[model samples]
Target: MSLLFYSCNSQKKAQKKEAETHKVIQKKYADLLNVSTTEIKNVRLYAFIEEWTGTPYKYGGLSKSGIDCSGFCNVLYNQVYQKELPRTTKDIAKQLDKVKQSRLEEGDLVLFNIEGKKNAHVGVYLQNNMFVHASTSKGVIISSLENPYYKKAYNKGGKV
Candidate 1:
Protein backbone atom coordinates (compact mmCIF):
# COMPACT_ATOMS: atom_id res chain seq x y z
CA MET A 1 0.00 0.00 0.00
CA SER A 2 2.78 2.41 0.82
CA LEU A 3 4.55 1.65 -2.52
CA LEU A 4 1.38 2.37 -4.48
CA PHE A 5 0.93 5.66 -2.61
CA TYR A 6 4.48 6.67 -3.41
CA SER A 7 3.99 5.87 -7.10
CA CYS A 8 0.89 8.05 -7.25
CA ASN A 9 2.69 10.91 -5.55
CA SER A 10 5.56 10.68 -8.01
CA GLN A 11 3.17 10.79 -10.96
CA LYS A 12 1.48 13.85 -9.58
CA LYS A 13 4.80 15.59 -9.11
CA ALA A 14 5.82 14.79 -12.67
CA GLN A 15 2.60 16.22 -14.05
CA LYS A 16 3.00 19.34 -11.98
CA LYS A 17 6.52 19.84 -13.27
CA GLU A 18 5.37 19.44 -16.85
CA ALA A 19 2.63 21.99 -16.41
CA GLU A 20 5.06 24.46 -14.89
CA THR A 21 7.50 24.00 -17.75
CA HIS A 22 4.74 24.60 -20.27
CA LYS A 23 3.74 27.80 -18.55
CA VAL A 24 7.29 29.06 -18.60
CA ILE A 25 7.65 28.33 -22.29
CA GLN A 26 4.37 30.07 -23.05
CA LYS A 27 5.34 33.11 -21.05
CA LYS A 28 8.72 33.34 -22.76
CA TYR A 29 7.21 33.26 -26.26
CA ALA A 30 4.35 35.54 -25.31
CA ASP A 31 6.91 38.15 -24.29
CA LEU A 32 9.01 37.61 -27.38
CA LEU A 33 6.01 37.86 -29.72
CA ASN A 34 4.46 40.65 -27.72
CA VAL A 35 1.22 38.80 -27.24
CA SER A 36 -0.68 37.60 -24.23
CA THR A 37 0.21 34.20 -22.85
CA THR A 38 -3.25 32.94 -23.71
CA GLU A 39 -2.64 33.83 -27.34
CA ILE A 40 0.12 31.25 -27.58
CA LYS A 41 -1.86 28.14 -28.39
CA ASN A 42 0.92 26.10 -29.89
CA VAL A 43 3.64 25.55 -27.34
CA ARG A 44 5.57 23.11 -29.53
CA LEU A 45 5.80 25.64 -32.35
CA TYR A 46 7.13 28.31 -30.04
CA ALA A 47 9.62 25.91 -28.53
CA PHE A 48 10.91 25.00 -31.96
CA ILE A 49 11.29 28.65 -32.89
CA GLU A 50 13.15 29.33 -29.68
CA GLU A 51 15.52 26.47 -30.48
CA TRP A 52 16.35 27.75 -33.96
CA THR A 53 16.23 31.44 -33.30
CA GLY A 54 19.42 33.32 -34.25
CA THR A 55 20.77 30.56 -36.46
CA PRO A 56 22.95 31.96 -39.25
CA TYR A 57 21.56 32.27 -42.75
CA LYS A 58 23.17 30.36 -45.59
CA TYR A 59 22.14 30.07 -49.23
CA GLY A 60 21.54 26.31 -49.19
CA GLY A 61 22.57 25.19 -45.75
CA LEU A 62 20.17 22.99 -43.75
CA SER A 63 21.78 22.42 -40.34
CA LYS A 64 21.84 24.41 -37.11
CA SER A 65 25.03 26.28 -38.13
CA GLY A 66 23.28 27.77 -41.17
CA ILE A 67 19.92 27.62 -42.93
CA ASP A 68 18.14 29.51 -45.69
CA CYS A 69 14.61 30.83 -45.82
CA SER A 70 13.13 27.82 -47.52
CA GLY A 71 15.24 25.43 -45.51
CA PHE A 72 14.07 26.97 -42.27
CA CYS A 73 10.45 26.89 -43.34
CA ASN A 74 10.76 23.32 -44.49
CA VAL A 75 12.31 22.22 -41.24
CA LEU A 76 9.67 24.07 -39.28
CA TYR A 77 6.76 22.62 -41.20
CA ASN A 78 8.07 19.11 -41.15
CA GLN A 79 8.74 19.15 -37.44
CA VAL A 80 5.73 21.10 -36.26
CA TYR A 81 3.02 19.98 -38.66
CA GLN A 82 4.41 16.66 -39.92
CA LYS A 83 4.28 18.11 -43.43
CA GLU A 84 7.07 17.82 -45.94
CA LEU A 85 7.83 20.83 -48.10
CA PRO A 86 9.81 21.28 -51.28
CA ARG A 87 13.39 22.50 -51.01
CA THR A 88 13.15 25.68 -53.07
CA THR A 89 10.95 28.66 -52.30
CA LYS A 90 9.50 28.69 -55.81
CA ASP A 91 8.58 25.04 -55.70
CA ILE A 92 7.05 25.39 -52.26
CA ALA A 93 5.04 28.36 -53.46
CA LYS A 94 3.78 26.36 -56.39
CA GLN A 95 2.26 23.76 -54.07
CA LEU A 96 0.31 26.21 -51.94
CA ASP A 97 -3.12 27.70 -52.46
CA LYS A 98 -2.77 31.44 -52.84
CA VAL A 99 -4.17 33.48 -49.99
CA LYS A 100 -4.47 37.22 -49.51
CA GLN A 101 -2.32 38.92 -46.91
CA SER A 102 -5.35 39.96 -44.86
CA ARG A 103 -6.51 36.35 -44.68
CA LEU A 104 -3.29 34.86 -43.46
CA GLU A 105 -3.45 32.61 -40.38
CA GLU A 106 -0.98 30.91 -38.15
CA GLY A 107 1.30 28.42 -40.00
CA ASP A 108 0.68 30.05 -43.37
CA LEU A 109 3.58 30.63 -45.75
CA VAL A 110 4.52 34.20 -46.65
CA LEU A 111 6.27 34.54 -49.98
CA PHE A 112 8.23 37.55 -51.07
CA ASN A 113 9.49 38.84 -54.40
CA ILE A 114 12.93 40.26 -53.81
CA GLU A 115 14.80 42.27 -56.44
CA GLY A 116 11.99 41.75 -58.96
CA LYS A 117 12.27 37.96 -58.79
CA LYS A 118 9.04 36.25 -57.89
CA ASN A 119 9.10 34.05 -54.78
CA ALA A 120 12.66 34.97 -53.99
CA HIS A 121 12.15 34.73 -50.25
CA VAL A 122 9.83 32.81 -47.93
CA GLY A 123 8.81 32.74 -44.27
CA VAL A 124 6.48 30.99 -41.88
CA TYR A 125 3.76 33.24 -40.61
CA LEU A 126 3.23 33.17 -36.84
CA GLN A 127 0.60 35.63 -35.67
CA ASN A 128 -0.29 39.31 -35.59
CA ASN A 129 1.58 39.91 -38.88
CA MET A 130 4.74 38.48 -37.39
CA PHE A 131 6.67 35.86 -39.34
CA VAL A 132 9.86 33.88 -38.82
CA HIS A 133 12.54 33.65 -41.50
CA ALA A 134 16.22 33.42 -42.21
CA SER A 135 17.10 36.85 -43.49
CA THR A 136 20.23 37.33 -45.52
CA SER A 137 21.39 40.05 -43.18
CA LYS A 138 19.90 39.09 -39.84
CA GLY A 139 19.94 35.32 -39.88
CA VAL A 140 16.93 33.69 -38.27
CA ILE A 141 14.64 36.29 -36.78
CA ILE A 142 11.00 37.15 -36.33
CA SER A 143 9.85 40.14 -38.36
CA SER A 144 6.69 42.06 -38.92
CA LEU A 145 5.04 42.08 -42.29
CA GLU A 146 4.41 45.78 -41.80
CA ASN A 147 8.11 46.54 -42.20
CA PRO A 148 8.66 48.73 -45.25
CA TYR A 149 10.90 46.29 -47.08
CA TYR A 150 8.61 43.34 -46.44
CA LYS A 151 5.54 45.32 -47.39
CA LYS A 152 7.04 46.28 -50.71
CA ALA A 153 8.33 42.80 -51.44
CA TYR A 154 5.28 40.87 -50.25
CA ASN A 155 4.13 38.58 -53.00
CA LYS A 156 1.32 36.51 -51.49
CA GLY A 157 0.31 34.32 -48.58
CA GLY A 158 0.28 30.58 -49.18
CA LYS A 159 -1.77 27.93 -47.41
CA VAL A 160 -1.00 24.27 -47.56
Candidate 2:
Protein backbone atom coordinates (compact mmCIF):
# COMPACT_ATOMS: atom_id res chain seq x y z
CA MET A 1 0.00 0.00 0.00
CA SER A 2 1.05 3.58 -0.73
CA LEU A 3 0.51 6.32 1.86
CA LEU A 4 -0.06 10.00 1.02
CA PHE A 5 2.96 12.22 1.42
CA TYR A 6 2.19 15.23 3.56
CA SER A 7 4.14 18.15 5.00
CA CYS A 8 2.56 20.75 7.24
CA ASN A 9 3.53 24.32 8.10
CA SER A 10 0.69 24.93 10.57
CA GLN A 11 1.74 21.94 12.59
CA LYS A 12 5.27 23.27 12.67
CA LYS A 13 4.08 26.71 13.73
CA ALA A 14 2.08 25.54 16.72
CA GLN A 15 4.86 23.21 17.75
CA LYS A 16 7.35 26.07 17.56
CA LYS A 17 5.24 28.04 20.02
CA GLU A 18 4.99 25.22 22.54
CA ALA A 19 7.28 23.86 25.24
CA GLU A 20 8.95 21.32 22.90
CA THR A 21 10.72 22.24 19.66
CA HIS A 22 11.24 19.95 16.67
CA LYS A 23 9.77 16.68 15.49
CA VAL A 24 12.38 14.64 13.71
CA ILE A 25 11.46 12.03 11.15
CA GLN A 26 14.35 9.92 10.09
CA LYS A 27 14.38 9.63 6.35
CA LYS A 28 16.38 6.46 6.67
CA TYR A 29 13.70 4.78 8.74
CA ALA A 30 10.65 6.45 7.20
CA ASP A 31 11.78 5.16 3.84
CA LEU A 32 11.39 1.65 5.20
CA LEU A 33 8.07 2.18 7.00
CA ASN A 34 5.30 4.68 7.66
CA VAL A 35 6.10 7.47 10.09
CA SER A 36 3.41 8.55 12.52
CA THR A 37 2.65 12.20 13.25
CA THR A 38 3.21 12.30 16.99
CA GLU A 39 6.03 9.86 16.86
CA ILE A 40 7.92 11.31 19.86
CA LYS A 41 6.85 14.52 21.54
CA ASN A 42 9.07 13.35 24.35
CA VAL A 43 12.00 13.32 21.95
CA ARG A 44 11.15 16.79 20.62
CA LEU A 45 11.88 18.26 24.03
CA TYR A 46 15.52 17.26 23.92
CA ALA A 47 16.19 19.78 21.17
CA PHE A 48 16.11 22.70 23.57
CA ILE A 49 18.32 20.92 26.08
CA GLU A 50 21.50 22.08 24.39
CA GLU A 51 20.38 25.70 24.01
CA TRP A 52 22.28 26.94 27.06
CA THR A 53 25.63 25.39 26.28
CA GLY A 54 28.48 27.84 26.96
CA THR A 55 26.25 30.19 28.96
CA PRO A 56 28.08 31.53 31.95
CA TYR A 57 27.01 30.51 35.42
CA LYS A 58 25.82 33.23 37.75
CA TYR A 59 24.10 33.65 41.09
CA GLY A 60 20.73 35.41 41.31
CA GLY A 61 20.91 36.31 37.63
CA LEU A 62 19.48 35.01 34.38
CA SER A 63 21.13 35.58 30.97
CA LYS A 64 23.83 34.31 28.66
CA SER A 65 26.34 36.44 30.57
CA GLY A 66 25.53 34.29 33.59
CA ILE A 67 22.81 31.99 34.89
CA ASP A 68 21.91 30.16 38.05
CA CYS A 69 20.69 26.57 37.80
CA SER A 70 17.01 27.42 38.12
CA GLY A 71 17.50 30.62 36.20
CA PHE A 72 18.97 28.70 33.34
CA CYS A 73 15.95 26.47 33.16
CA ASN A 74 13.69 29.46 33.62
CA VAL A 75 15.22 31.36 30.74
CA LEU A 76 14.91 28.29 28.57
CA TYR A 77 11.22 28.06 29.36
CA ASN A 78 10.56 31.73 28.69
CA GLN A 79 12.62 32.17 25.57
CA VAL A 80 13.37 29.03 23.64
CA TYR A 81 10.36 27.01 24.71
CA GLN A 82 8.11 30.08 24.89
CA LYS A 83 6.75 28.81 28.21
CA GLU A 84 6.88 30.25 31.69
CA LEU A 85 8.19 28.54 34.81
CA PRO A 86 8.73 29.32 38.44
CA ARG A 87 11.80 31.28 39.42
CA THR A 88 13.52 29.38 42.21
CA THR A 89 14.66 25.80 42.31
CA LYS A 90 12.40 25.06 45.25
CA ASP A 91 9.35 26.52 43.56
CA ILE A 92 10.09 24.90 40.25
CA ALA A 93 10.37 21.51 41.90
CA LYS A 94 7.04 21.99 43.57
CA GLN A 95 5.46 22.94 40.23
CA LEU A 96 6.20 19.59 38.64
CA ASP A 97 5.00 16.09 39.24
CA LYS A 98 7.34 13.72 41.07
CA VAL A 99 8.06 10.84 38.78
CA LYS A 100 10.17 7.70 38.88
CA GLN A 101 13.71 7.74 37.62
CA SER A 102 12.88 5.03 35.10
CA ARG A 103 10.21 7.25 33.51
CA LEU A 104 12.50 10.19 32.74
CA GLU A 105 12.26 11.80 29.29
CA GLU A 106 14.35 14.27 27.31
CA GLY A 107 12.45 17.39 28.28
CA ASP A 108 11.85 16.21 31.83
CA LEU A 109 13.15 18.42 34.62
CA VAL A 110 15.96 16.93 36.73
CA LEU A 111 16.58 18.11 40.25
CA PHE A 112 19.73 17.59 42.28
CA ASN A 113 20.76 18.10 45.84
CA ILE A 114 24.35 19.12 45.45
CA GLU A 115 24.42 19.90 49.15
CA GLY A 116 22.55 16.71 50.07
CA LYS A 117 19.29 18.51 50.72
CA LYS A 118 16.18 18.94 48.57
CA ASN A 119 15.55 21.00 45.45
CA ALA A 120 18.84 22.80 45.60
CA HIS A 121 19.78 22.42 41.95
CA VAL A 122 17.85 21.88 38.75
CA GLY A 123 18.55 21.06 35.08
CA VAL A 124 16.83 20.48 31.76
CA TYR A 125 17.24 17.05 30.22
CA LEU A 126 19.01 16.55 26.92
CA GLN A 127 19.17 13.42 24.83
CA ASN A 128 20.91 10.17 25.72
CA ASN A 129 20.88 10.54 29.49
CA MET A 130 22.38 14.01 29.40
CA PHE A 131 21.20 17.37 30.78
CA VAL A 132 22.25 21.03 30.71
CA HIS A 133 22.55 23.41 33.65
CA ALA A 134 24.48 26.39 34.86
CA SER A 135 27.09 24.98 37.16
CA THR A 136 28.06 26.96 40.23
CA SER A 137 31.67 26.17 39.55
CA LYS A 138 31.48 26.12 35.75
CA GLY A 139 29.43 27.64 32.98
CA VAL A 140 26.36 26.04 31.51
CA ILE A 141 27.20 22.60 30.24
CA ILE A 142 25.78 19.20 29.47
CA SER A 143 26.39 16.23 31.72
CA SER A 144 25.53 12.60 32.01
CA LEU A 145 22.80 11.29 34.29
CA GLU A 146 25.30 8.79 35.66
CA ASN A 147 27.85 11.45 36.55
CA PRO A 148 29.13 10.56 39.98
CA TYR A 149 28.25 13.87 41.60
CA TYR A 150 24.75 14.16 40.16
CA LYS A 151 24.01 10.46 40.53
CA LYS A 152 24.64 10.45 44.25
CA ALA A 153 22.88 13.75 44.94
CA TYR A 154 19.89 13.39 42.62
CA ASN A 155 16.50 14.39 44.03
CA LYS A 156 13.54 14.03 41.64
CA GLY A 157 12.39 15.32 38.25
CA GLY A 158 9.18 16.41 36.51
CA LYS A 159 7.82 17.96 33.34
CA VAL A 160 8.45 21.68 33.12
Candidate 3:
Protein backbone atom coordinates (compact mmCIF):
# COMPACT_ATOMS: atom_id res chain seq x y z
CA MET A 1 0.00 0.00 0.00
CA SER A 2 2.80 2.38 0.81
CA LEU A 3 4.57 1.57 -2.45
CA LEU A 4 1.37 2.18 -4.38
CA PHE A 5 0.87 5.50 -2.66
CA TYR A 6 4.43 6.57 -3.39
CA SER A 7 4.15 5.62 -7.06
CA CYS A 8 0.91 7.53 -7.46
CA ASN A 9 2.40 10.58 -5.77
CA SER A 10 5.46 10.46 -7.97
CA GLN A 11 3.34 10.17 -11.08
CA LYS A 12 1.32 13.19 -10.06
CA LYS A 13 4.45 15.21 -9.52
CA ALA A 14 5.78 14.23 -12.91
CA GLN A 15 2.52 15.23 -14.52
CA LYS A 16 2.61 18.60 -12.82
CA LYS A 17 6.16 19.23 -13.96
CA GLU A 18 5.24 18.38 -17.53
CA ALA A 19 2.28 20.72 -17.47
CA GLU A 20 4.41 23.56 -16.15
CA THR A 21 7.12 22.97 -18.71
CA HIS A 22 4.55 22.96 -21.48
CA LYS A 23 3.06 26.21 -20.27
CA VAL A 24 6.44 27.89 -20.16
CA ILE A 25 7.27 26.60 -23.62
CA GLN A 26 4.01 27.90 -24.99
CA LYS A 27 4.54 31.32 -23.51
CA LYS A 28 8.06 31.61 -24.86
CA TYR A 29 7.04 30.55 -28.36
CA ALA A 30 3.90 32.68 -28.35
CA ASP A 31 5.93 35.76 -27.45
CA LEU A 32 8.59 34.98 -30.01
CA LEU A 33 6.11 34.42 -32.83
CA ASN A 34 3.82 37.28 -31.82
CA VAL A 35 0.87 34.94 -31.55
CA SER A 36 -1.15 33.33 -28.81
CA THR A 37 0.11 30.08 -27.30
CA THR A 38 -3.14 28.52 -28.46
CA GLU A 39 -1.93 29.08 -32.00
CA ILE A 40 1.00 26.79 -31.41
CA LYS A 41 0.15 23.11 -31.84
CA ASN A 42 3.69 21.67 -31.85
CA VAL A 43 5.43 23.04 -28.81
CA ARG A 44 8.69 21.21 -29.43
CA LEU A 45 8.97 22.39 -33.01
CA TYR A 46 8.03 25.94 -32.15
CA ALA A 47 10.48 26.11 -29.27
CA PHE A 48 13.28 24.65 -31.36
CA ILE A 49 12.71 27.13 -34.12
CA GLU A 50 12.52 29.98 -31.64
CA GLU A 51 16.00 29.15 -30.37
CA TRP A 52 17.48 29.64 -33.86
CA THR A 53 15.39 32.59 -34.92
CA GLY A 54 17.28 35.48 -36.49
CA THR A 55 20.46 33.50 -37.02
CA PRO A 56 22.31 34.50 -40.17
CA TYR A 57 22.41 32.25 -43.24
CA LYS A 58 25.77 31.00 -44.39
CA TYR A 59 26.71 28.42 -47.00
CA GLY A 60 28.31 25.33 -45.46
CA GLY A 61 27.87 26.83 -42.01
CA LEU A 62 26.37 24.76 -39.20
CA SER A 63 26.26 26.80 -36.00
CA LYS A 64 23.92 29.48 -34.67
CA SER A 65 26.21 32.20 -36.01
CA GLY A 66 25.41 30.97 -39.53
CA ILE A 67 23.49 28.11 -41.10
CA ASP A 68 21.97 27.27 -44.42
CA CYS A 69 18.50 25.91 -45.13
CA SER A 70 19.64 22.30 -45.28
CA GLY A 71 21.81 22.66 -42.21
CA PHE A 72 18.86 24.05 -40.29
CA CYS A 73 16.66 21.19 -41.44
CA ASN A 74 19.28 18.60 -40.51
CA VAL A 75 19.76 19.92 -37.03
CA LEU A 76 16.07 20.39 -36.45
CA TYR A 77 15.30 16.78 -37.36
CA ASN A 78 18.13 15.42 -35.26
CA GLN A 79 17.25 17.49 -32.24
CA VAL A 80 13.47 17.53 -32.37
CA TYR A 81 12.61 14.13 -33.85
CA GLN A 82 15.76 12.29 -32.85
CA LYS A 83 16.24 11.29 -36.48
CA GLU A 84 19.24 11.71 -38.69
CA LEU A 85 18.63 13.42 -42.03
CA PRO A 86 20.80 14.21 -44.98
CA ARG A 87 22.79 17.43 -44.95
CA THR A 88 21.69 18.68 -48.35
CA THR A 89 18.25 19.66 -49.46
CA LYS A 90 18.19 17.13 -52.30
CA ASP A 91 19.37 14.25 -50.20
CA ILE A 92 17.01 15.16 -47.43
CA ALA A 93 14.12 15.08 -49.83
CA LYS A 94 15.11 11.57 -50.78
CA GLN A 95 14.74 10.42 -47.17
CA LEU A 96 11.15 11.55 -46.97
CA ASP A 97 7.92 10.02 -48.12
CA LYS A 98 6.43 12.57 -50.48
CA VAL A 99 3.40 14.38 -49.15
CA LYS A 100 1.02 16.58 -51.00
CA GLN A 101 0.91 20.25 -50.13
CA SER A 102 -2.73 20.06 -49.05
CA ARG A 103 -1.94 17.11 -46.80
CA LEU A 104 1.06 18.56 -45.02
CA GLU A 105 1.30 18.41 -41.22
CA GLU A 106 3.61 19.72 -38.55
CA GLY A 107 7.17 18.26 -38.76
CA ASP A 108 6.94 17.70 -42.50
CA LEU A 109 9.77 18.96 -44.66
CA VAL A 110 8.77 21.56 -47.23
CA LEU A 111 11.06 21.44 -50.21
CA PHE A 112 11.50 24.28 -52.69
CA ASN A 113 13.12 25.26 -55.96
CA ILE A 114 14.32 28.71 -55.03
CA GLU A 115 17.29 28.55 -57.38
CA GLY A 116 15.45 26.89 -60.24
CA LYS A 117 16.79 23.55 -59.05
CA LYS A 118 14.74 20.89 -57.33
CA ASN A 119 15.11 20.69 -53.58
CA ALA A 120 17.27 23.82 -53.46
CA HIS A 121 15.69 25.08 -50.29
CA VAL A 122 14.04 23.33 -47.36
CA GLY A 123 12.13 24.26 -44.25
CA VAL A 124 10.30 22.56 -41.43
CA TYR A 125 6.54 22.76 -41.53
CA LEU A 126 4.75 24.31 -38.61
CA GLN A 127 1.06 24.73 -37.97
CA ASN A 128 -1.17 26.77 -40.29
CA ASN A 129 1.09 26.30 -43.28
CA MET A 130 3.99 28.21 -41.77
CA PHE A 131 7.57 26.87 -42.06
CA VAL A 132 10.91 27.91 -40.58
CA HIS A 133 14.03 28.06 -42.72
CA ALA A 134 17.33 29.86 -43.12
CA SER A 135 17.04 32.08 -46.14
CA THR A 136 20.03 33.51 -47.89
CA SER A 137 18.37 36.89 -48.09
CA LYS A 138 16.51 36.86 -44.79
CA GLY A 139 18.54 34.65 -42.50
CA VAL A 140 16.43 32.46 -40.27
CA ILE A 141 12.71 33.27 -40.56
CA ILE A 142 9.27 31.81 -40.52
CA SER A 143 7.37 31.98 -43.79
CA SER A 144 4.10 30.81 -45.12
CA LEU A 145 4.14 27.93 -47.61
CA GLU A 146 1.20 29.69 -49.23
CA ASN A 147 3.06 32.92 -49.91
CA PRO A 148 3.34 33.67 -53.61
CA TYR A 149 7.09 33.33 -53.53
CA TYR A 150 6.97 30.00 -51.76
CA LYS A 151 3.99 28.81 -53.74
CA LYS A 152 5.90 29.47 -56.90
CA ALA A 153 8.92 27.58 -55.66
CA TYR A 154 7.09 24.93 -53.67
CA ASN A 155 8.01 21.41 -54.63
CA LYS A 156 6.39 19.09 -52.10
CA GLY A 157 6.17 18.22 -48.42
CA GLY A 158 8.16 15.23 -47.16
CA LYS A 159 7.84 13.03 -44.10
CA VAL A 160 10.46 10.59 -42.97
Candidate 4:
Protein backbone atom coordinates (compact mmCIF):
# COMPACT_ATOMS: atom_id res chain seq x y z
CA MET A 1 0.00 0.00 0.00
CA SER A 2 2.85 2.39 0.72
CA LEU A 3 4.33 1.61 -2.67
CA LEU A 4 1.05 2.43 -4.34
CA PHE A 5 0.80 5.67 -2.43
CA TYR A 6 4.29 6.66 -3.50
CA SER A 7 3.46 5.88 -7.10
CA CYS A 8 0.40 8.06 -6.97
CA ASN A 9 2.38 10.91 -5.54
CA SER A 10 4.97 10.50 -8.28
CA GLN A 11 2.30 10.57 -10.91
CA LYS A 12 0.92 13.82 -9.58
CA LYS A 13 4.37 15.30 -9.52
CA ALA A 14 4.95 14.21 -13.10
CA GLN A 15 1.71 15.85 -14.20
CA LYS A 16 2.66 19.06 -12.48
CA LYS A 17 6.08 18.99 -14.11
CA GLU A 18 4.52 18.43 -17.50
CA ALA A 19 2.24 21.42 -17.03
CA GLU A 20 5.25 23.57 -16.19
CA THR A 21 7.05 22.30 -19.26
CA HIS A 22 4.13 23.28 -21.43
CA LYS A 23 4.22 26.83 -20.14
CA VAL A 24 7.92 27.02 -20.91
CA ILE A 25 7.35 25.75 -24.42
CA GLN A 26 4.52 28.17 -25.01
CA LYS A 27 6.58 31.06 -23.77
CA LYS A 28 9.52 30.09 -25.97
CA TYR A 29 7.36 29.87 -29.05
CA ALA A 30 5.64 33.13 -28.21
CA ASP A 31 9.00 34.80 -28.03
CA LEU A 32 10.07 33.46 -31.39
CA LEU A 33 6.81 34.50 -32.98
CA ASN A 34 7.06 37.94 -31.45
CA VAL A 35 10.48 38.48 -33.05
CA SER A 36 9.09 37.28 -36.40
CA THR A 37 11.92 34.79 -36.67
CA THR A 38 11.98 33.59 -40.30
CA GLU A 39 11.32 30.07 -39.13
CA ILE A 40 8.17 29.43 -37.07
CA LYS A 41 8.27 26.31 -34.94
CA ASN A 42 4.59 25.52 -34.79
CA VAL A 43 2.84 25.83 -38.14
CA ARG A 44 0.23 23.76 -36.37
CA LEU A 45 -1.90 26.77 -35.52
CA TYR A 46 -4.69 24.28 -34.84
CA ALA A 47 -2.66 23.10 -31.89
CA PHE A 48 -2.99 26.56 -30.45
CA ILE A 49 -6.65 26.83 -31.48
CA GLU A 50 -7.66 23.93 -29.28
CA GLU A 51 -5.87 25.50 -26.32
CA TRP A 52 -8.35 28.35 -25.75
CA THR A 53 -11.42 26.57 -26.97
CA GLY A 54 -14.66 26.87 -24.98
CA THR A 55 -13.61 29.63 -22.58
CA PRO A 56 -16.58 31.55 -21.23
CA TYR A 57 -17.23 34.98 -22.73
CA LYS A 58 -17.24 38.22 -20.78
CA TYR A 59 -17.29 41.91 -21.54
CA GLY A 60 -14.05 43.88 -20.96
CA GLY A 61 -12.32 40.57 -20.44
CA LEU A 62 -9.21 39.08 -22.00
CA SER A 63 -8.75 35.85 -20.13
CA LYS A 64 -10.28 32.40 -19.78
CA SER A 65 -12.88 33.57 -17.25
CA GLY A 66 -14.41 35.60 -20.10
CA ILE A 67 -13.49 37.45 -23.25
CA ASP A 68 -14.93 39.76 -25.85
CA CYS A 69 -14.63 39.32 -29.62
CA SER A 70 -11.58 41.46 -30.16
CA GLY A 71 -10.21 40.22 -26.89
CA PHE A 72 -10.23 36.74 -28.38
CA CYS A 73 -8.27 37.90 -31.40
CA ASN A 74 -5.81 39.84 -29.31
CA VAL A 75 -5.14 36.88 -27.08
CA LEU A 76 -4.78 34.44 -29.97
CA TYR A 77 -2.39 36.60 -31.92
CA ASN A 78 -0.31 37.47 -28.90
CA GLN A 79 -0.10 33.91 -27.71
CA VAL A 80 0.17 32.09 -31.05
CA TYR A 81 1.77 34.65 -33.33
CA GLN A 82 3.39 36.64 -30.51
CA LYS A 83 2.08 39.87 -31.95
CA GLU A 84 0.34 42.43 -29.77
CA LEU A 85 -2.64 43.76 -31.67
CA PRO A 86 -5.12 46.48 -30.88
CA ARG A 87 -7.75 45.16 -28.48
CA THR A 88 -10.91 46.74 -29.82
CA THR A 89 -12.58 45.21 -32.86
CA LYS A 90 -12.72 48.60 -34.46
CA ASP A 91 -9.00 49.16 -34.04
CA ILE A 92 -8.17 45.74 -35.39
CA ALA A 93 -10.54 46.30 -38.30
CA LYS A 94 -8.45 49.12 -39.70
CA GLN A 95 -4.97 47.84 -38.83
CA LEU A 96 -4.62 44.80 -41.02
CA ASP A 97 -4.37 44.67 -44.77
CA LYS A 98 -7.45 43.09 -46.33
CA VAL A 99 -7.29 39.60 -47.75
CA LYS A 100 -9.78 37.58 -49.70
CA GLN A 101 -11.68 35.20 -47.48
CA SER A 102 -10.93 32.36 -49.89
CA ARG A 103 -7.23 32.74 -49.14
CA LEU A 104 -7.45 32.93 -45.36
CA GLU A 105 -4.82 30.87 -43.53
CA GLU A 106 -5.12 29.51 -40.02
CA GLY A 107 -3.61 32.54 -38.29
CA ASP A 108 -5.59 35.09 -40.22
CA LEU A 109 -8.09 37.17 -38.21
CA VAL A 110 -11.68 37.73 -39.27
CA LEU A 111 -13.86 40.77 -38.72
CA PHE A 112 -17.64 40.89 -38.86
CA ASN A 113 -19.43 44.13 -39.56
CA ILE A 114 -22.87 44.48 -41.00
CA GLU A 115 -23.20 46.45 -44.16
CA GLY A 116 -22.98 50.18 -43.45
CA LYS A 117 -21.96 49.32 -39.89
CA LYS A 118 -18.65 49.73 -38.15
CA ASN A 119 -16.60 46.66 -37.27
CA ALA A 120 -17.73 45.26 -33.95
CA HIS A 121 -16.37 41.74 -33.66
CA VAL A 122 -13.31 39.62 -34.41
CA GLY A 123 -12.16 35.98 -34.39
CA VAL A 124 -9.35 33.67 -35.44
CA TYR A 125 -9.59 31.42 -38.48
CA LEU A 126 -9.53 27.63 -38.20
CA GLN A 127 -10.24 26.37 -41.70
CA ASN A 128 -13.10 25.52 -44.10
CA ASN A 129 -14.73 28.84 -43.32
CA MET A 130 -14.64 28.11 -39.64
CA PHE A 131 -13.33 30.48 -36.97
CA VAL A 132 -13.11 30.60 -33.17
CA HIS A 133 -14.60 33.37 -31.09
CA ALA A 134 -15.90 34.30 -27.66
CA SER A 135 -19.42 35.41 -28.33
CA THR A 136 -21.42 37.65 -26.05
CA SER A 137 -23.58 34.72 -24.98
CA LYS A 138 -21.93 31.69 -26.56
CA GLY A 139 -18.57 32.15 -24.88
CA VAL A 140 -15.46 30.85 -26.61
CA ILE A 141 -16.50 28.57 -29.45
CA ILE A 142 -15.79 27.66 -33.02
CA SER A 143 -18.11 29.31 -35.55
CA SER A 144 -18.96 28.83 -39.18
CA LEU A 145 -18.07 31.74 -41.36
CA GLU A 146 -20.86 30.61 -43.62
CA ASN A 147 -23.37 30.81 -40.79
CA PRO A 148 -26.19 33.14 -41.73
CA TYR A 149 -25.30 35.58 -38.96
CA TYR A 150 -21.63 35.88 -39.85
CA LYS A 151 -22.33 35.72 -43.58
CA LYS A 152 -24.65 38.69 -43.46
CA ALA A 153 -22.35 40.67 -41.18
CA TYR A 154 -19.07 39.77 -42.86
CA ASN A 155 -16.64 42.62 -43.08
CA LYS A 156 -13.25 41.18 -44.10
CA GLY A 157 -10.36 38.97 -43.00
CA GLY A 158 -6.74 39.95 -42.28
CA LYS A 159 -3.39 38.24 -41.69
CA VAL A 160 -1.29 39.33 -38.74
lDDT of 4 by residue, 1-160 (tens): 9999999999999999976666565565445334332233354454565566778888898887887888888877877778999978888877888899999876788988755676878888765677778887788787788889999888899865
lDDT of 3: 0.86
Per-residue lDDT value at 5 in model 4: 100
Query: What is the TM-score of each predicted model, taking all chains together?
Result: 0.89, 0.68, 0.79, 0.69
Model 1 agreement with the true structure over 27-121: per-residue lDDT tens digits = 98788778999999988898889899999999999989999999999999999999999999999889989888888888999999999999999
Shift in Å, residue 128, candidate 2: 2.3
The TM-score of predicted model 4 comes to 0.69
Candidate 3 per-residue lDDT, tens place, 89-108, comes to 88888888998888888789
Candidate ranking (TM-score, best to worst): 1, 3, 4, 2
Q: Would you give me the overall lDDT of model 2? A: 0.71
Q: Over all chains combined, what TM-score does candidate 1 have?
A: 0.89
Task: List clashing residue pairs in candidate 3.
Answer: none
Q: Which candidate leads the pack in lDDT?
A: 1
- Residue 75, candidate 3: Cα error in Å is 0.6
lDDT of 4 at 31: 53
Per-residue C-alpha lDDT of model 2 across residues 120-140, encoded as one tens digit per residue: 999986445667788888888
- For candidate 3, give the lDDT of residue 111: 90
Where is the poorest 10-residue window by lDDT in model 1? 25-34
Ranked by TM-score, the better of candidates 1 and 3 is 1
